[model samples]
Target: MTGPRSARSGFSLVELIVILALSTIVMGGLTSVLVRQQRFYRGTADLIETRSQIRQAAGIIPSDLRGVSTAGGDIIAISDTSMLFRATIGQALACAPVPLANRIDIPPLTLANKNTLASFSMTPGLGDTVFVYHDGATEAAGDDVWVPYGITGAPTMSSVSCGDLIGSADLTTPRYSFPLASPLRADVTPGTPLRFVRRTRYTLFTASDGAWYLGYCSPDCAGSTPQPIAGPFLSGAGGTAGVAFTFRKADGAITAIPDSVAEVSIVVRGRTRGIVDMGGYKNTQVGDSLRFSVAIRNRK
Candidate 1:
């Protein structure tokens, strides 16, 4: 006779396997959804960062671009690396909250020589860059750097001196150079500039006749060189490929002189970093690019 039937409370191997398989399928679907959501968030974040960075630049460049002291080349002769940078100075009276009955005259400013040192920071090229072709080639060209000396109190203001040039890498160092002018993308309303503004601008021309390209630099000269300073400021790789500056005629309004780059543009190309296929991990990485442009103000 068989022993009393054992009251078993255990799942068979097949049942266990079935349960595990079903659980795994459900989990897998949940994981896929989660991963997709994460990716979406990441992409959105990246896009936001890109826009923010470019916009920051835009906020500053305009004032300085309109202030450019010189402008040459035909209407559309700029390229990726270089464009005309004009400088204008709003005198304390002109820029002051108080309205002036007479026109206020602002003096011109200058960036000091590279060797001198004191408080301000210095880039590699003394606020200058080698204007090159899109191929990253730099041939003999005009001085890519131009320091303007216009604006309020500048004429009588002390010239940029050894004391003005900071030796440290970071601009905020105790001896940081002045922010003489706002970058060419910011405020259009003319006003009094900060006392510690820069006095130089740089242009990089990657192409000759014309093509899309980026143009960025400190509103006024600061560091010893533009290379080290502007290089980092440029669009980081996997980000925008170029920042284009544009010069356009404002509607029917025409200046006896040609109206040029009242604004600059920021263009970018973003790329995908990476992600897993079915594993829900960072395995299969890919890349793509995104682009953006902004017409930064050149004055005020």
Candidate 2:
């Protein structure tokens, strides 16, 4: 007779242990990769958002602060933590007619119903210290503290009283090299590079017309303030105002405002959501750091 036999279907202890160990190793590797990728995606999202914010914030001044000024002097004050400055406003839309060149019949720059300085603390620049008819030379090395324009390198003319505007000469050569007490044929040095050319000066007659518009200037374009500059870029066509600057420090023992704050440095905070591993835990660090400068377009 055969001896009694017993059967067992379950795995051996060693086999089960090996299988568990293998699964653990695979899981660890996948977790590591997921963590790293999640961080990367979050960082990318934050960066894109920051870049967009920088662009929008930076554009506010350069594009609009062409001629911003105030009667109490050029006004400059920061608006908020993310944004900056909220200076008083003043500017007009006037009809300036040039004599000739491109768009021979563009019409005059129409004045706006009211004067809005359109001044804000969006940009920071040494240019704030500089004025349309400033009395000094430019610093070719450091900043634009007194970047002289005059009829030389930049605009010198005031209003487009006439229909004529300036023309494009060689960038390599500048026509007038100094400020003038007044405008006339004598302001420029005769040659191919006309310091001043005759062109059309268009304006936004009713915010509907698309040539150019007038800006406002207080008690005259002086002090530390900005004059609104609407459209149709022109030479010597600048407005002015006074500038007052302040700073905010994060240090527990906050020190006095730094002089270097010719511009305001801002870290714009924004949010974005996306599918990512470790969703909250892994990407928390990714959504926070972006910095851009909101300089005072007019920093003296």
Candidate 3:
């Protein structure tokens, strides 16, 4: 029909097929890379979340243990998953004029004789239990024993003056106003400082959801149903041996007596979240553990 048909300006079937094959290869590589990146991001996120949870669990344990009472028989019990002990709610430095009776007179022990009327730490609330400790009498050398006495009452600010104990007013020393649960077994000597603390029984239990939680009660562990302190935890996951405790005496000997325990070593172990059972690829669960020791100051 025509002298010589001009070569077609469009690609031939062979060229089109080749171009399609190359595009398929490039797209396959891109898809593979995208999938790999997605997996990496997911793994990283899981690790970070798990570590955060571990840190939260670890931080709370020490803070609670630090407040343990130093009085004899303060620690009620200790086990793999449970612990009961007394904790201090408030403390003061010194008691100058002594032989305290039903009331405690708190003076300004601060520098420059500053009146710490509102700064007293032992303002007990209702349903609160307090323990008084006399720090003056020396039972023996280096045997600073704190004589504990229990109290149960709401505290009030007292301004009336009685005997040598002076109440802080517009021109007097401040004092803690509360009724003692009972009179001291013996007199609190002069220059002997006093300490007040609240005792609580803390129990860590495994909930129905397979998570660990902290529960607490007042006076004694068997008095009431334990209420959770914060939220669920993953610290108790390792079957029967997940959580453990070891006690030591002040003389550095292992002791079973709860009162003689000066140091407690706690160990917690568990696997991170998002654990999978894929063979080889996810053969084992990523687990972490936290171990630390708490020195019971009062017991020691």
Candidate closest to the true structure, highest TM-score: 3
Q: What is the TM-score of each candidate against the true structure?
A: 0.41, 0.29, 0.66
For residues 186-294, could you state the per-residue lDDT of candidate 2 as single tens digits?
1221111111111111111212432222223322233423333332211222221011112333332322333223444433233333433344544343333234444
> Could you report the Cα RMSD, in angstroms, for every candidate shown?
15.5, 16.9, 5.6
Q: Would you list the rank order by lDDT, best first?
A: 3, 1, 2
lDDT of each: 0.35, 0.31, 0.58
Q: Where in model 3 is the C-alpha error above 4 Å?
A: 1-27, 66-71, 93-123, 126-129, 133-145, 160-176, 183-192, 214-240, 250-254, 276-283
lDDT of 3 by residue, 1-300 (tens): 669777879899999999999999999999999976776666666655655655665676667677675455657777666677655566653333335466554444342335332233445554444444444457664545466544556655544343333333332444455566566545454334555655566556665666665556765666466666533445553553445577888887987778788888776555545653332346345666678888886554
Off by over 4 Å in 1: 1-3, 67-80, 84-199, 202-241, 248-300
User: What's each prediction's clash count?
Assistant: 75, 67, 1
lDDT of model 3 at residue 268?
58
Q: Best by lDDT, which number?
A: 3
